[model samples]
Target chain A: MTDPTASAEPPSGPPARRRGRPSRAASAGTRDRILTAAREEFSAHGYDKTSVRQIAKAAGVDSALVHHYFGTKEQVFAAAVEVAFAPALAAPDTLAEGPADGVGERLARFVLGVWENPTTRAPLLAILRSAVTNETAAAVFRRLVAAQLVRRVAARLDLPDAELRAELAAAQLVGTALMRYVLKLEPLASADVEEIIARVSPVVQKHLTQP
Target chain B: MTDPTASAEPPSGPPARRRGRPSRAASAGTRDRILTAAREEFSAHGYDKTSVRQIAKAAGVDSALVHHYFGTKEQVFAAAVEVAFAPALAAPDTLAEGPADGVGERLARFVLGVWENPTTRAPLLAILRSAVTNETAAAVFRRLVAAQLVRRVAARLDLPDAELRAELAAAQLVGTALMRYVLKLEPLASADVEEIIARVSPVVQKHLTQP
Candidate 1:
């Protein structure tokens, strides 16, 4: 099987996808491959060391093609991080269906759920590694996380300090990620998901609902 | 005037600092200078790119002097991070004097207080930059933070799951540091310290006191 994430069309199927726009970059699934390569490379080598040429080589594309689609190394990282954060970005809307009181549990479970999966966790870790080490990369991550995730959740709160509340909630989850995933400190690392959720969800609820 | 952090003895007055062990490295304050340079170099260039020769150059000493005092770049980082985290390490014990009910506020304010000061915050940001990007450096940092601070705080809580509780509290503060200091995301970043403490203390309190 050709990597299922590349495109909807099967590998044995036709060369073209999206009949209206026949751009080879999209049609051939080269962009997805490049992103996959970029995430792996960045995760392995970090932001400062990883180069556009390396990402292109890993993607089996010319450097020009990587640049044509993603611009600079920083830009490539930005795009990769955005894709990594997709589940998190959609969380506010998808988890907002319940009453505000339950928003904490819903959001906590959802955020932790993303980290619980190794596939999703890797890219997010890459984004975090880059942000912590490189200022330019940090700016990209800060903008995406703030404007895309936290601010959206804040907007749903309809409170004066909704932004701060959302940020605190983000900080809590992000901090846990650093320790449990990156640092792998136990028993936080080894604790069952249910145990963590039971302890953390109430804190999340308090941040969202407290006056 | 000599750098005050180097030693109590005047730079011009006496070469012997402790008089017990007049080791030239300790007496002349060469060790202190190396550490200072190491912290600055690591902060400026990051862990992977920095070298012992460069640190020695910045300290105005021979590379052998750096090697003599600190052994390796990673060892130098350990020493620097330990110094950087001294304030935080002292906190679990010093701040524990208050009633259990006030542990949250005292701990929150104290941790934020460490971040509030630019002098203490820089080395921490440097350590964080290294830990996120390099696995070896991350291990050094993980051990220091987990053993020196979190575990100590856990021991104090006297709860069965005190370790997890302390880790959660740490996650809260560390997360705030990433957003507020490293990422500089606002209003969390630009927001007044008092305002943050007020909003955050209650969350911290719940993490520690909630069983």
Candidate 2:
């Protein structure tokens, strides 16, 4: 493991990479460490309160290194959001796996399934909380979700106003996540996962395919 | 220091509220003024940062009177949620207004319409932001929504697991609100209200009426 503070110990705080090229694997590892730390910080403190310095400290790196790697707090947050949403953004592909009639169920199950797992749920919730409260975070989030998930999902639909349809479908899943996971609204929160999948999948299906 | 004329009916008031102070009557106008101030405070500062003193100051009432009428800050928030949700909680009756197929559109329109109105949207957004971030806020929000809206709507549905169905339907609308209003995600955010109602109504119809 790289010494997180070694570079900063020098008079100039240039990242070790700037002094000399490190092994690609080591560089990737450092990047990953920073990202993990970013996720944890963002998840715990949210976007408005979390600072790059805090993330660097958490990762045992200098704040300059975080700037070197991610440019800004907003960028770091975007990167963190990307990691959390990567799997779910692949949802359009998931939707293609089953018959069109079952697409709604598959899509519903896919989105909710991501939330069902504890490990993934933390960062997603963190991203969502930040998005709701912070304007910058929300813009970054809206851009990614709009660009990555909604538009792609829209592309898959063979319908008029496909963008609207895709977003509406997104609204269904996002809302379910808020109620069941974020707010922990009862009935929805306590209801069986499969039962929810059974009930909501059809609604999703209609949004995706129906007129 | 009690102003007998200001609260002449305090001791024998029908409201029977006895928490903040005995300085004011639990008159509807005064109670509403406190609640309005509370909603504005909570909306602007969220649950954690807002205080009874601030709410009372905004309403030109004593803090003790706020406590008197609302008991605790949590109770005050519950009261605020009740006001914002008053019309929404009565959605069961709205469902009874039109033909079965049209129910979804009517419901969708009713909800988005609430959001469309500036006066209503602000407090709702504030309440939503608070609920998502604070545990007590979430509990109060969840309880109000579950008790007031979901269960009532569930009672209207003649289906098995009616409560679950009602909650699922709620997820759809809440998610849409998160996207369109809270996050203000594009496409969905800019889409015409009628268009949204058209797209989302059938989905609601399925959730409320279908097996």
- Least well predicted 10-residue stretch by lDDT in candidate 1 chain B: B9-18
Model 1, runs deviating above 4 Å:
A1-28, B1-28
User: Root-mean-square deviation of each candidate, in angstroms?
Assistant: 7.1, 5.6
Task: Sort candidate 2 into its docking category.
Answer: medium
The candidate scoring highest on DockQ is 2
Model 2, which residues run further than 4 Å from truth? A1-23, B1-30, B60-62
Worst 10 residues of 1 chain A by lDDT: A9-18
The deviation in Å at residue A99 for candidate 2 is 2.8
Give me the TM-scores of chain B across the candidates: 0.85, 0.85
Candidate 2 clashes between residue pairs 3 or more apart in a chain or in different chains = A175-B175, B19-B68, B20-B64, B20-B67, B20-B68
Each prediction's whole-model lDDT (CA)? 0.81, 0.81
Residue A53 lDDT (model 2): 89
